[model samples]
Target: MSCPFAQSPRSTPNRIPKRSSSERDSIYEVIDAAPLCHVGFTQQEQPFVIPTLHARSGDTLLFHGSTQSRLLQAIASGRPICCVFTLLDGIVAARSAMHHSMNYRSVVAFGTGRLLEDEALRQQAFRLTTEKLLPGRWETCRQPNEAEAKATAIAALMIEEATLKQRSGGPNDIESDLSGPFWAGVLPIQTVIGKPIPADDLPPGVEIPSRIASLTTSG
Candidate 1:
């Protein structure tokens, strides 16, 4: 049931660097903090990429979209896909230009995608996806109608070939360039939380929940 990427080394190709325990730890952190991923694949030898919402169950990443979606159709046809989920923690600044680099954690997964058909499993996948974006959104939003559900497409990708790489240090400038006066360094960046905008159609008396308010200040 697991993607090929999550399998032992003997089971899949190693396209990226072998991930150490430290690297693995960082991957989990980055993935958990984000709910979207960039999926790359080739259709007819032409490269294609798409951004999709995803949920990580243990080591497998699940994606669901419209059945007629070009991306989903490509995957269902057995095309190989490369999924990259990344988090940018900060940009590093270095005294020398050559040494400048950003701090980042990312996971690259490759595999063939497939259509998910089990009714119960699809419901579970829907729930997992809902919980990832919002703690209790599924319960709050109106459930999907039969027509809506029928129009959707659910997919599960096996992590076959994968690796996690993280670069997070001062600067990697060459020793010779270290003496250079040119200013160079990662410009540390972060995702900032802003005040929540209440829904325009929301009832006048419905108060903003503390949870929604908290997200505004949360990293």
Candidate 2:
């Protein structure tokens, strides 16, 4: 099915201005690079925002948790949810405090979570999630057992509406502020993965998997 967001006119209330194909790519890049997302929803008149790992499958976003988890249960109830993912690229220092800003890419999506009732779909979701977390490791690792799958609750959110906001480069300092005696530039930031440490009980001759080895540096 086509993405719901793609079916409508561009006249919508969104904070960010997404007017180009490159900007859409930036949105997807941020979502793919960030492993965690904050899901916001309300339960019993109380608002909640929880962080969890997520995987994007085409126009749908997948996430799972314990079957008995209150958050998962709430989501499965069909209430609307707001999913947010962001990546901080740098800090912009400007001569004027008002002009100071940061470089970031963010995606805000709105959808209602649907529980994956079909066993086959749930299994597929699990596989997709695992692969997204660590590519090539799922093939080498053992699959989940029936009992484990039974205890897990998987859900998919069809991205009905979404918006992407991004800010890059240095601060937009005014002409007068540009002449001030103050340093102004972007302080680049990145997330790096350190060398993997083997488990204490790891059997001998078991070398690091290619997926793990590849994570030794920032990808």
Candidate 3:
């Protein structure tokens, strides 16, 4: 079968990437590496965007949430879906207000989601969740019990269409405005890992793992 998330040779009129060419290959790589996504689906004709813990198994996204959430219900009811993940690295400043911008990477995935019912698959999804938060965590922690597994719902979304848009480098001001009096540059921002705060119930000699302690920064 043709790659679902790959660029279409056919015409697209309502597309968002009219100004920039879509980076399809790089986007799939990033989506596979990223840990979470903001998934949006409509409920009663109203919009809803939910920050969800997810895993990308190739082109499929595994999203698990409370069994009773409306978003899950909407997905089950056949609403079209979009999952977005953005990494904002910095703010780009320009000489003029009109040229202000941000240096970032983001992916928008368009797909329809179906609730996953296989018990084994649900357990694997939960395991993927722990691994996403901390590599190698699935083996270290106690596996989910039967009751816990049944209480949660796991859904898989097959990405039918996707795109990536990136804006980087210097300001895009007109030639005449390049020499404007206002200062202009990018103010970079990133995620920093703070010192570990151990759980209150930890024993006196418990220590944090090296894998977690080494996460110095992220975007």
Q: Judged by lDDT, which candidate is best?
A: 2
lDDT of 2 by residue, 1-219 (tens): 223354234324344545222234555667788878999999889999999988888778899999998768877888988888988989999888888888887777777888999998998999988987887778888999999999999989887767666788878888987778999898999988787888999999998877778778733
Candidate number that wins on TM-score, 2 or 3: 2
RMSD of 2: 3.1
Give the per-residue lDDT of model 1 (tens digit) for 82-196: 8888888788887764556678877777777778889887887888888788766677677777888789888877666566666776676677776776776556767766877
How high a TM-score does candidate 1 get?
A: 0.81
On lDDT, the stronger of 1 and 3 is 3
Q: Candidate 1 lDDT (Cα, whole model)?
A: 0.72
Would you estimate the TM-scores of all the predictions? 0.81, 0.89, 0.86
Off by over 4 Å in 2: 1-26
What number of clashing residue pairs does each candidate have, in the order they appear? 16, 0, 0
**lDDT by residue (tens digit), candidate 3, 1-219:** 334345653213255454333455677766766666898877767888988777876677887778997767666555678888888879998988988988877777777788888887788888877787777767766888878878888888887777776677878887888776988888988666677788989999866666776764521
TM-score of 2: 0.89
